[model samples]
Target: MNASPQFRVLRSRATETHNNLREEILAALESIIFESYHNSFTIRADLEVAFAAEVQSKFAVAAHSGTMSLFLALRACDIGPGDEVITVANSDISTTGAISQCGAIPVLCDVLANDYTINTDLVERSITDKTRAIMPVDMHGHPANVKALRPLADHYNLRIVEDAALAAGACDYGLPVGAFADVTVFSFSPFKPLGSSGNGAMLVTNDEEICDKLRLLVGYGHDPLRHGVKDGYQNYTAEGYNVPLDALEAAVLSVKLPYLKEWTAKRRAIVAALQDGLAGAPARLPSFRPESAPTFRSYMICVDRQFEIYQGLRAAGIEAAFSYAPPIYQYSVYAGAFPNSNELKVTDRLAKELVNLPITPEFSDSDVEYMIETTKDLLEKT
Candidate 1:
């Protein structure tokens, strides 16, 4: 069966945006080829400046991916083996993997049913003497309850790392997503709100000491200058990993950053349209908190008959997805890694019911209407 005309039209618009960016990317590559001398540090510095301006932070460190950004942030804060980090269960497995890579245990907490963000109450209850930090993931562009979570962290003397990968342009209570946490990480993968042509991620913090340590950690533990130390010259510091973001990705991100707000606004508008259209449908729309403005990274709806609906949407030639199905806790790798794995009730429920629909600046009003109508029809039949 052919895709709905509305679906085809919007998909074509997305393709056009991608193709235009590809052309710009090729032009950038040609310019780089012609340059007599390319200094990577100079490019990094420029990106740092651009990121600081965008997020209103003192320092921003670019890395190869968001996973590395999280690892670097945790390492900077001195979290490692024998420590536990409290985080949401309904998140990408990369969050858990990053914690594991640091040799820290990830204590998964259930999310709020409405927003799918970490339940601050569960986060507090999960804390232990071994707990080192609280990493709150801003799922699908909605900022977590940072104000409430920050106080909880302070009470426990724990650091906070905001996983702002899906929330580049989102803000909570007028503050940017990166503003409140001790350290915040943002991903610029092709699907993110502020994406580049390829993969990139960044860490931002107001603490100069943490920023300094992160710079060394992401740069293979070597001091930038390689200056003299007690024994002739010693530049290497802590044990670290090489996770620098490439120059090309940085350039592309710089180009895309300026349009992030506009793109995010368009996404939010689409979400509103979807909500209006699905008012009488069986699907449960995600609740928007007035205090925080979501950037709508992925427009998700929870519905009964999730699997059937997912298959139905695909059969109808619409591109829909199950975001984070088989919650991180259900992964084989996490089978017995932690003790309280089965406590994620809400996470389990969401994993079984959530469905993400097409959400992009390229999606048109008619496209959203078709999805809404198709979904209602599918649900009625089931």
Candidate 2:
């Protein structure tokens, strides 16, 4: 009988990404520490410009986290008290929480069984006289069909705030994922595709009005009227929060941003290999539309025995995670908050079955092979 393969324990992808960029990150830090003295905002501003250019947006606002970016985007859209924003229930709490934070209601929309993104066809039906915005999450780095929702949002005079926290380098319809939304947010938390050492995010928009609102909200409502005045007097136009992106994190992200495309390509290749290796292996892989090009945060696969497979992978030294299951609406914190939760049949099914397998640019070809073989063995037993 053949002996079992000894696989290296895969830990955090973010750590590997950081280790890989150690030199560049150190150089950026050195420059910021010595040269940037008292001009810390300039580092963040440079990142915002580079990020905006990369995402093909007219303006970008850097924020402390993706959650804050979502909130700022919602506020920029004037979504508040009694307004309803349609979003999916299968995403992280940040998606729904952003809407609720603004005193607006989040109308739960179910996701597609295949891609696990918001079912855009059903989004319009959720719209009401009070519907103010549509927030679609690109769950597991799969690009939601925001392009389809663009016309719907325009017709309803609604705003689309895409939560692409996991999809910084993804593209859809031959353009970056944010191209179709009024404002799109990309996260730089360590676990994301293009990650910084600490929490950071960028909100990108083509609308000058929305851009101004985001800046105002991020800078403690510092008067945009006096933005070009050059005077040091602090003035306020509206009540807002101070949550600008951390300058040091911005420096790290600036060093990493140029390598995003390369890392994203590596992620896609890893998913491709996983897709080919796991085919017909008692697990269901996610499907994407031809126009969608996704960068995987982790390669998600659904199986009948999610927990068993997840545990088995961990035992075999693969860092498989069982999360986002049972749906967010089922969480105790949300108990009875979303009465329409029962209607999310597909979302419920996905949450119960999904398991995320780690994928990183640092993964070796042998590492991917080990993952495939080990997961296939686990799935076969289940």
Candidate 3:
């Protein structure tokens, strides 16, 4: 039998980018070997500057993982026990996990039927005295109703921590996703659009005070006390966690940052082709406003017989999938811990219908044609 189509989801082009930056990586490695690996004033520090600029933010704080970025963002927003943070139910577990880790209640909300982002209308009603913040994730590399949510958050005097993990190069209304929220978090997991060689994430913001708090929080609550110690003691100012990005990952991310826009464009091109080809197919594809652009992190579509199609695709050597079926509350672990919005009809419907297909930038014309024809063929047969 022929090999299955290597449909690697959230595929990272890190290998290609790293190969291009081979000499730089080696030089950075040698520098680390000789200088004993300084986390600050090195590749990691440079990355903070470069990445912050790429995201159009005034400050960027690197972290060990995206979850850490989200946790710190939530903490910076003063979300914790008794404080409710409204967010969508259909997303990577990381989204809600960050809220839960910070001791905040994640009030699950439904996603819009068209784009599968947070229902901005549900947000205002969900806000009570305890709702301290609203975390709108950039679902499927497309902007949520973040701008619409801004008014609600402002009216309620709540913070907004945007999760742009899958939207590294996406823009909303001409502004990068990172530039529009109180604090925006981007993940560099190997699968993300702007992934690192390994794992890394960034928290970007324009607010100096929040930046200061996050910077200090990542370093065991050290109060801006530089490399050495004052009076032979490092002051632990607040309860914090030690979560800084690795220098090596930073080095890799630095190399890939420049190509992010090009890569995102490629993903968009492929999505356009697929959408055009599958015009009348029996699946609901993602839709967005003209002002917003998505990286098409994954091509999410809704269809009946989703499981049957998913299994058939796998059997036919495709890596098609349904990213977050059943939403969060439906998961066995948190079945009873969280309540599904009383009217998550669309969320529940999508839980059974949505499927993610290969939309990588590296896809060749033939590769994409194969995906389109294969999907159309499968849909017709099913």
On residues 14-83, what C-alpha lDDT tens digit does candidate 1 reach at each position? 3456576777656655555566336455666688788878889998889888988998899899999989
Candidate scoring better on TM-score of 1 and 3: 3
lDDT of each: 0.81, 0.87, 0.81
Query: Which one wins on TM-score?
Result: 2
Model 2 Cα shift for residue 108 (angstroms): 0.7
- Shift in Å, residue 270, candidate 2: 0.6
Candidate 3: segments with Cα more than 4 A from true spot: 1-13, 34-36, 39-41, 223-228
Error of 1 at 234 (Å): 7.2
| lDDT tens per residue, model 2, 275-316 | 999998998899999999998998999999988888898788
Q: What TM-score does each of the candidates earn? A: 0.92, 0.94, 0.93
Off by over 4 Å in 1: 1-15, 21-27, 36-40, 225-234
Cα deviation of 230, candidate 1, in Å: 13
How many backbone clashes are present in model 2? 0
- For candidate 3, write residues 1-382 as lDDT tens digits: 2223254332344566678779977777667667676643477778999988887799999998888889899888778887888888888788888888878888888888888888888888788888899899898888886888887888899999999888899998888896658999999987788887678999999998898889888878875535457788676767777888887777677767888999899999999999998889887887887888777888888888898888877766567767877788777767666652446888899989988786677777887788788888888884
Error of 2 at 233 (Å): 2.7
lDDT of candidate 3 at residue 337, scale 0 to 100: 66
| Model 1 alpha-carbon miss at residue 50, Å | 1.4
